[model samples]
Target: MIVARPVWAGSLSFGLVSLPVGLYTATDSHTIHFHQLQRGTSDRIRNRRVNERTGDEVELDDIVKGYDTGDEYVLVEPKELDEIAPGRSRSLEIAGFVDLSEVDLIFLDKIYYLGPRGAEYGKVYSLLEQALEKSGKAGIATFVMRQHEYLVAVKAENGLPTCHTLHWADEIRDPKKEIGDLPGKAKASDKELKMAEQLIEALSMEWNPEEFHDTFQERVVALIEAKRAGKTVEKAEPAAKATGAVDLMEALRASVERARSPKVTGGKAAGPGVIAEKKPGAKKRIRSTPPTDGNGG
Candidate 1:
């Protein structure tokens, strides 16, 4: 196993109990960005700050944050407003404990591994780790990082304390409000449902993260490389358009067939798709029918 270097030294607490620990990021992201260029001349793009209403170029020092209160009125901020919230950051404090299964995976925004910071705090940190491991539970905690207190989950992972960001209840928007309404209130036919279930079972496979790759990003990079080498860019086949359908039975049947097919499922055996409706025990099956608009044929 590779050892991780600590990024921040701190202590975790819950009323009286405290453990000296260090934090290290659990993952890293690599995203590609493009530089803008002029449409015809191929000159690099440049941005300037200008007053929207007056069409005047504004200097950096002259720029001030503002909010529109409506009716063409604006509220400008003063320089002192930048230091609105200021205080010495405190270490992670675990206020409570919870079952590991209770929290949803979507709530986790970031992950960090906590290591024992010093020899003196080793005993206390070890004790906490052991207790959490023994109970097979995680601690519900809050930590102040970058001046903002974040809700997090703390648990013992591979003999080390691990922290993951938590999503508050308010942060989760209600799907009903966004979805408005759904079609096909009726359930699927026995044959359709059975076929779907069989297709799912036939395509089952173990989770191996290494097998996955971001093909979209890879294609973009490959295109750039081809352009640099003065080679022709490959054109991939256009994706099939989706068609919406009112026939619940037909949709389920099509999906079941697709799921069972090796080519459609990505391989001889592939994991289920992420659509919640397609999951077993789900009340409704969201099928990829053609679009309601003429975009799909």
Candidate 2:
């Protein structure tokens, strides 16, 4: 088990079942960083805040967080805000249970791993995971992180519970409002659709995350390495074009074929539970129909 540097510690409760757990961030964005430089002299560029009308460097102490009101007006600090801030600091309190599938994917923000706080808390944590895994449910709760209240979802993950930060429904924009209205018809021919379906079927495979590479980051790193070695950085060649078919159906089929090839087989993968024992010849499958909401969250 990984010893977690917990960002927050609190209780996960639903009905009579309660367990002490800690939240640790699951995702990290620790890629290499770069700074802007003057091209010929290679001098590092530094930012300075100055009024456009009268050029002058602003002192750091003079900075304050503010909100823009209308007409370029700004709302500055208020002493009343300090008085009414949420009392709780770093704590995640589980409020209720929900079917994991009911929450839309767009609501998901950051993810974190929930670990048992101590040996005594292990049994309840395992029990909750087992029960939730069997029932296909997740716990929905509100918690305070960095003094801001957040809606979160805790679900069974690898014999433990994992927490996901969720954005409020109002925070998400409705596509209908932006796109106006979407067409309700299949514009392509039946043959084209059939080819597309076949392509998807051919390409279908288990999710193995290691296969996906952040090519942009990789390219940047390579360029940096080349520059450090006093070598000329080369531009990447254009990607090869697909040769299978010209229509949409052919394109999908080609994609499927590529996906199912031996080169795309196996890599690191994860799901919601521990693999206590491997089931021989078993393959995980995505449900054809959407999961029903499990009421007992």
Candidate 3:
């Protein structure tokens, strides 16, 4: 069994009880990455922090965060941030416990596994986990990690405690303000609504994450193999056309039939761009890259 190294170590305090614990990341990415290279050469492209005026590479130690205010930039030292929330950096103090159901799903962000620092603190950890599990509640806390303060909810999952970082309330954008063409107060016909419900029910299945794999990544690997062997890769089929309002009912009915089909449920049919099987030792050559968001952060 492989034991993961902790990213952060601190004491979790709730009321009078405090337990030494460590936080480990609960998720990983398996995206294939390629280095930026010159068009005609194998030379790699790299990023650097350099002075705009001098075009000289700057040492990381000499870099300080600056906030632009139109008139001037306000520089702040890294140590100043830690000094402002010194206790938060090493303490996970629960403010209160709240019903897990009451928390909105949109607020939840990254998840991390929390474990006891040593055998001596296992009992305390277990007690908190069991209590939270039995009560169906989560302990809300705030702590600083890597210079950023995060709101988190510690809850029990599969006999262990898991910490989920939460987005601040203000961070959630109002859909009403952001979406210009939202169909507000629009009502569907009873027949159409009933058909959609049936389609949903037909498509519903148990949440087994193991059943799904990254088909797109597999195609990427297949493309690389095909190119290496001097073979041409087939293009994927075009996506189904969007249904107009006039054809909505017909589309829903067709979707329901498709959902109930045996091929979609049990049979393995190689559709466009589907790779049947990966070659042995092929995965070893693939490099894992960090997952990026819309802004490429």
Candidate 4:
């Protein structure tokens, strides 16, 4: 396995257990990125930090964080902040453990893989991962990373402890208040509910992530390739327009009928864990159905 460079070096501390660990980024984005430039020209658009009042470009060394305090700004020096940081700001302390599901999905932020700092620390790391996995618990912890103290949850991912930073409780906004006229007390009729459920059943799919594609991104790449080749590129046909929702009952019934009609399933790609195995030459038919790890640290 390819190991990534550690983003932070810290120890996971709990009742008499301090396992030295390093946090490495777990994911990398694959989206194509672009740079800003002047229209019709190659002049790159650049951003520079300048003092708003002085209009002078500021040096990185001279930049310091300041909090607006109504009357004056509270300037905090890095050294001063470090002086009051937890464990001299070098360790992540597990404040407590909770059932993994107890944490709200809304609070989840970013994930990172955790690894033992060295071969000697492997034993403690494995012990913690296994214990948390068996208990169905996650260790709630906090630590400084990139000069900011983050609230995080530690859990196992593929038999190893993984860290996921979370949003502070106060940071989560109430959806009811954020959205206007949300159907807080909306109710569905029994027939409607049943039809909805049946429709979901017909269209249900296995958790095969490979079937999904970033079609837009693929088209963008194709465009770039055509330009590189100096060939005339054909524009893709416009996407099929989405139909308006039908009367609930009609939509559900049609969906069920569509699912029950058998089709060529022999070449259909199955998702992981969808079927134990696929046997070639087996007379497989698609039934129209309707419907449709982590560790603790």
Each prediction's Cα lDDT score? 0.68, 0.66, 0.83, 0.75
Selected candidate, larger TM-score, 3 vs 4: 3
Q: 222-246 in candidate 1: lDDT tens per residue?
A: 6455444434443454556664546
TM-scores, all candidates, are: 0.68, 0.68, 0.86, 0.79
Candidate of highest TM-score: 3
lDDT of 2: 0.66
TM-score-best of 2 and 3: 3
Per-candidate clashes, comma-separated: 7, 6, 0, 26
Query: In terms of lDDT, which candidate is stronger, 1 or 3?
Result: 3
List all candidate RMSDs to the true structure: 12.6, 16.4, 7.5, 14.0
> Order of all candidates by lDDT, from best down to worst?
3, 4, 1, 2
Show pairs that collide, candidate 1. Answer: 242-290, 242-291, 243-289, 243-290, 243-291, 244-289, 244-290
Residue 224, model 3: Cα distance from true site in angstroms: 1.2
Report the lDDT tens digits of candidate 3 across residue range 1-297: 998889999999999999999999999999999887544344567999999999999999999999999999999999998899888899999999999998999999999999999999878989999999999999999999999989999999989999999999999999999999999887899999999999999988899989999877887777666545534455554578888999999999998998888763332222223223323434233222222221210
- lDDT of residue 79 for candidate 4: 75
Better of 1 and 4 by TM-score: 4
Pairs that collide, model 3: none
Which stretches of model 2 miss by more than 4 angstroms? 1-4, 16-18, 47-91, 179-184, 239-246, 249-297
Off by over 4 Å in 4: 1-3, 86-88, 230-246, 260-297
> How well does candidate 4 match the true structure in TM-score terms?
0.79
